[model samples]
Target: MTLLEKLNQDMVQAMKNKDKDTLSVIRMVKASIQNESIKLGKEHLTEDEELTILSRELKQRKESLQEFTSAGREDLSEKVRFEINVLEQYMPEQLSLEELHEIVEQTIQEANATSMKDFGKVMGKVIPLTKGKADGSQVKKIVEQKLK
Candidate 1:
């Protein structure tokens, strides 16, 4: 099934099961997807577009988790962590560090990115290859180290 269809089904299941947290998160995701569709002047989004929205949501939750933890708000941190967990359930399986390294190495060779100046060139090629599978920041760090 499509991502939107799956989200709708899960949303209904959350409501029926009285899972407030899951329901809230799922609703927010739907709203984000709808907003994105409006922004693009389109009636529907592709799975790739949906994954981009999901990734953005996951990034926001991660930032919130860090902020809450640093502020000593354990309760808030816990809630954010739970939301992160829920969001993660819909994300593609993350790439392992080893797998990420291999991809970066291959991209570097393919892009002939031998210096830091070639960072963007390498990233432009790698980002799409690793999208939804690896975090951009992680991939950037790996590329930087390899280039150095």
Candidate 2:
């Protein structure tokens, strides 16, 4: 099923199951997708666009979880963590270090990136390759290490 359809189905399930936390997170994600569509002047978002919105929301939750934990707010942190877990359920499976490294190696060769100066070129090619499957910062670090 499409992401939006899956979200709608899960939202209904959450409501029936009285799963308030899951329901809240789903609502937030749906709202973000709607906002993104409106922002881009599109009636419907492509799957890639939906994934981008979901990634952004997941990043925000991770940051909030860190902030809450650092501030000694265990109650808030736990909730944020739960939200993170819920959101992650919809994300593509993350690439492992080995898989990411292989992609980095291939991208460097494909782009003929020979030095740090070519970092942008390599990244431009790599980002789309990894997209929702891998974290950009992690891929960047790997690319930098490899190039140097």
Candidate 3:
């Protein structure tokens, strides 16, 4: 099933099972996605747009979790973590380290990126290929190391 279809299915299951937390999180996600579409004045988002929205949501939750944890607010941190887990259920499988390494090599070659000065060209190729799969910061670090 597509991500939105799966989200709908899970929403029904949450309601049937009387899972308040699950239901709340799912509703929040649905609302967030709908709001995005409304902001765009569109009937539907393309798959890439949807993935971008989901990734942004997950990143926000992760950052919130970090801030809460650093403040010793375990309760809030756990809640953020729960939301992140729920959002993650719909994301594409993350790229493995080895997979990222291989792609970085290919990107380097394809860009003729001989030094850090050519990092932008390398990243231009890498980002689209690794979109929703690899972490941007991680890719940058590896590419920088390769260039150096």
* Model 2 misplaced stretches (Cα beyond 4 Å): none
Global CA lDDT of candidate 3, please?
A: 0.88
lDDT of 3 by residue, 1-148 (tens): 6567778999999999999888998888788888999999998888888888888888888889989999999999888888888888888999999999999999899777899899899999999999899778899899888999
TM-score of 2: 0.97
- lDDT per residue (tens digit) for residues 30-86 in model 2: 999999999999999999999999989988988899899999999999999999999
RMSD to the true structure for each prediction, in A, is: 0.7, 0.8, 1.1
- Kindly indicate the candidate among 2 and 3 with the higher TM-score: 2
Clashes of 1: 0
**How much lDDT does candidate 2 score?**
0.94
Which stretches of candidate 3 lie above 4 Å from their native place? Answer: none
lDDT of 1 at 131: 93
Better of 1 and 3 by lDDT: 1
The CA root-mean-square deviation of candidate 2, after full C-alpha superposition on the true structure, stands at 0.8
User: What lDDT tens digits, residue by residue, belong to model 1 across residues 109-136?
Assistant: 9887889999999999999989999989
lDDT of 1 at 88: 92
